[model samples]
Target: MRLLVSFLLAGLITDGEAQNWHGPHPWRANAVVDGRARDYNNEYFLHAFSYRHLIDRPSPIEEGIRGTAGSLTSDRLYMDFRYQQSFAFDDPDQAFTLDIQRAEDFDGSYDRQLVGFRQTLAQRWQLSLQGDVFSDKSLTDIYFGARRLHSEGSWLQLSLVLPNAYFNDKTDSQSELIDEPRTLFAQWHQQHTPWASTTLSVNHTPDATLDDRTQGDRVSSRQTRVALRYREQKGNWQLQTDLNGEHTRRQHQLDERPAPQAFRRDMASLTLAVRYWPHRWQPQVGARYFWLDEDGWFGREPNGNGEVSRQEPMLFGGMSLSLSDTQRLAPTVYLSRPRVEQTVNSPRWRDRDDHGFVGKLSVPWHITVSKQNGAVLSIVPSMRLHRFAFGGGNVQLHWPL
Candidate 1:
């Protein structure tokens, strides 16, 4: 992820806009004139960065053009397979389970399969094994866990996650997989009452350096994350909130670079959502705040160290209006103001600064078909205009199984 940031920074310093000698980095002008000019790819990088950092995307975009959900109405077909079952023994105290799920996206973005098995050793105790198989075998993962039910409505889980668990997979070096560290995961969930519940989870990955043979680089990283979630239902309203924080330190050694580069990043986020479920209108509201700070050497050059900071707060509001006994229209709007700043040499030189208030509006029409097992099919088509000029339009389809 930081690699993209480094490339973007390089583009900013080499683009045509930086040719003038008005800025402090007058030396960059010579570099730009000496054949290190940025080409048309600069716009692509800027849009990609903006889409990830600033835009409130409504759905996943495939190949920078089409939305995943919107593609359902097109000629292409996509499908997912899922199967799960539990087997009981004569002892009545022992049982076995099998699970399999595969997602096949037409765009080849989420092509993966999960196979898992669980066995009950004793009452209220179970053990499980799960594996994730990705299109790239080097990215596979495996988990071995045990779950204990402490009470009627509470449980605890502990697991060991083996990152890049695949070995001798013809695709990558076996030594790189063997050197990856095993991550630790723990979670606790409790139900206080019929209407309220809470959950806490923690994950930690110790420092380790592994050869990314596929990319011809070396990465050393350590990360820890803690999160909590709360959900409750009171009267005619339902509420859910989440809080999480993470710290990460990473260093990268490119094959072409002689020196190693490193960075540290800290992030925190809060979210709250409320819905008046029992009301006719079914109004909903939610808000989220996220902040991040990163400082480190992002480029191959030693002098390419920098700091990046971002803060984003967003609000969401929506309601459902019944059009008929079998039809409804739900429209939701999102408003956000995101601020970002990037500087090199501490606070001495500013590289990029941007802040803006943007919004997105979505209106979806829901249709119920009783013959199709009362399935709810939603067709969402949206268009926008600014200053009497057409901006753009999009369409999406949703059908639940």
Candidate 2:
């Protein structure tokens, strides 16, 4: 229902003694178009741009830029564009994408200036791709893979993505060692009940060299999750409970080492919340129990270290009140064990048993700026105070679209 163009530019100008004019110049822009075309027809478009400049004295600082644009047509035609600067060579950025498909048109456009296609026949499967070209090295990464949706509600999805590559000037000396990294991933999702869900995913990144010493090796990460939620709603009182468990594993090489390091972590949490909503005010109280276990080498320690575990309990309470139709106020309080942890061999391990309290409050005012443009803006001011934290402050901002 709204088409908005947003732009942001930020840069840091430093004045050091020797490098008097040095810092990073960063800028970003985003454009979003959303509206309904006709009955039951929706269209949307999004564009984003980001640029960063690194400045040095004797030599000019490197400049890098990235841009992306995507749109969903009224007739289900989806298109995307992506480009990134190559700081090593003064070359224009590249762009690519997968072409739109119709029921009968499979061999569509392969225009060199605007689009191209590639087909690969692997031992087990076939892959088809098409995309536009901006420069020689940069191309849009696209792929499609699907799996069966079984009768028991289990579904699987497999996909391969070949993203664009940008030359890193810092590691240009070792460019030969760094290869372009590609990602392969598979995910499975299942719904066992109305209040329960499970997901399993695995992601693999092939060896991509950034430098000779850091010849990136194939890394694989896997995650499995199960969550259960229960809610009871009666009149003005509500009760809810959510429980979840997750396990993750990551394996990767470091510093051209042949042996790969593996890390595994497990986490489980349970939260119980109760709320009462009246005509003008709503109050909620919640408590959570969390447990975490981590094992294996984190690449810092040469010899593999044993596992570590932590348990924490947290309590939270919040309330919201509506002063009028266009104004609201909310405040929340949280108490949790300190996040600092001590290793078994550390000398000050006893200092990890502390607790802290955090309090936050927010108020929002909705104002109608224009009637013809249907413009409405909400301004919110928030503040956070932590008893034992390092920084505390208040924030005020108008919500941007």
Each model's C-alpha lDDT?
A: 0.50, 0.35
The local lDDT score (0 to 100) that residue 328 gets in candidate 1 is: 84
lDDT of 2 by residue, 173-226 (tens): 333323554556565655443323344455454444322233333344444444
**Per-residue accuracy of model 1 over 257-319 as CA lDDT, tens digit each:** 798767777887776778787678878788877677777754222234677787877776778
Candidate 2 Cα misplacement greater than 4 A, ranges? 1-221, 225-234, 238-245, 252-260, 299-309, 338-340, 344-401
TM-score of predicted structure 2: 0.42
RMSD to native, candidate 2: 18.7
In model 1, the runs with Cα more than 4 Å from the true position are: 1-112, 133-140, 150-152, 166-179, 295-307, 324-327, 342-352, 366-378, 382-401
Question: Against the true structure, whose lDDT is highest?
Answer: 1
